[model samples]
Target: MWTIYLGLTGLAAANPQVVGLGNYTGALEDPRFLTSLWLTVLYVGGSAIIGQAGLGFTLAGILRTRTGPVRRLVEGVVLLSWIPPSTVVGFLWFALLDRDEGTLNALLHTPGFAWLLDHPLLSIIIFDVWRGTAFSMMLYAAALENVPPAHLETARLADAGVLQQPRDVVFPASAATS
Candidate 1:
């Protein structure tokens, strides 16, 4: 209610006045607003759909066949990225991407590359993917369990390639959950 009232009137400003729709119109007309909106859509869609879902599904599929310490180690590392608080994760990523003394810059031998400023959208999308992939991985891991081992074995015996097994057998079995 307060937000609507503020948006409808000029009461939010130092000098209050009844400027109904002016604020909304101004925001709509601003080029920066449009750019920010577009970037936001792109970032979220790319991260959630392309990056997180795809990578998580792939990881889950690969890990489904494996067992023992290798699987545990990979799952632990992925979950560690998702388990931390957002603030802690943000601070760590900030340190990693910082211009002068960042770990990334040091590793790449690019001393002063401003990653956040130069590639804000890409950075945020990648961060979101890293932060959110564990959920997708776990979800797909459970879903992949629904896929019958017999079906996978049948596909393998039929000479299905690595990608074909997932597309034909695993995907059909897991489509409901997906």
Candidate 2:
């Protein structure tokens, strides 16, 4: 992959003397590198899996039933977040959390939390959730649309509400389709 090539190129450029297992051992011992790995795992699990999965499914279910101006507006907002460049998201978050006079601190009327210095991991995790939830919403919207209306109606006739209907009918329908 181009990714491997790029990584190797950067490695070779950064440390010409670094070779083979030595580089690997050095990297493994690097605290910053290790912390980066942990942060990545946390972000993937917390934001991508948990935040995205739950919110996406919930929004998709709503979009499936609700149609009109409200749905259109919400979809537009989600799509806007989904399409922005990563750098823009990072910049926007930086502004929002900029300790000294960040709007969040002002609005919350609390002392600034030293996020960038002390809790960069949590800061990035929050950023990831905010930026990535829309993607999950979009994916789930498609998934929800594919569920059969007849099945939903049948589940309703069986005296099932939202939770029961989705659990008994929608999830099984999705599983079979997948």
Candidate 3:
């Protein structure tokens, strides 16, 4: 083990020196890099903050008490978003958002509108939200479902509705990190 570790260390030492910070500085000096950074921030804010955490929480809360075949159907559809590959999600979004022959543009009959070129950041954000929000919703569903019965009963005794109980008890409990 010592010999192997020494060999690995020697191999690493033999590699050419790489100035990681210099590369970062060079990239940061480029206008394209700044634009990319802005786009990345926009994507994260729009999809993760606004779409996933916001809308996903609402969907989970609304579906929490839903039962029967309709609930199952909804679950199935939502699970599809969670189960597919990210690349597949991107491709599907591209198909829908394509300029000339895209499904959305065709359905809306909005000719000459290039979704990809005109709204690259927004397009990616929408695709990411569509693909990733299901996981957040499912997580919220599980968290809400696993609330302690005693707390729920206490909330019930206090005349809290299902919605109120989750807000007052379950959400805080599940959101807390050790």
Q: How do the residues 1-178 of candidate 1 rate in per-residue lDDT, one tens digit apiece?
A: 9888788888557876778899999999999999999987898789999989999998998999899999999999999999989999999999999999899999999999999999988999999999989999999999999988999999999999998998899889888656
For candidate 2, write residues 31-111 as lDDT tens digits.
999999987888788877877787778877888778899999988887787687888877877777878877677788855
lDDT of 1 at 135: 91
Q: What lDDT tens digits, residue by residue, belong to model 3 across residues 1-178?
A: 7644543342356673444355557768999999999878887899999988877887887787688898888878877988978788778888888888799998999976899999877877877787778888888888877767687789899999867986898777777731
Q: By TM-score, highest first, what's the ranking?
A: 1, 2, 3
Query: Candidate 2: lDDT of 160?
Result: 98
Kindly provide the TM-score of model 2 when superposed on the true structure, using C-alpha atoms.
0.71
Model 1 clash pairs?
A: none
Q: Ranking by lDDT, best first?
A: 1, 3, 2
Of the pair 1 and 3, which is ahead by lDDT? 1
Give every collision pair in model 3. none
**What shift in Å separates residue 130 of candidate 1 from its native position after superposition?**
1.0
Could you list the CA RMSD of all candidates, in the order they appear?
4.0, 4.6, 6.0
Model 1 / residue 24 / CA error / Å:
10
lDDT of 3 at 131: 78
Off by over 4 Å in 1: 1-34, 176-178
- lDDT against the true structure, each candidate: 0.92, 0.77, 0.79
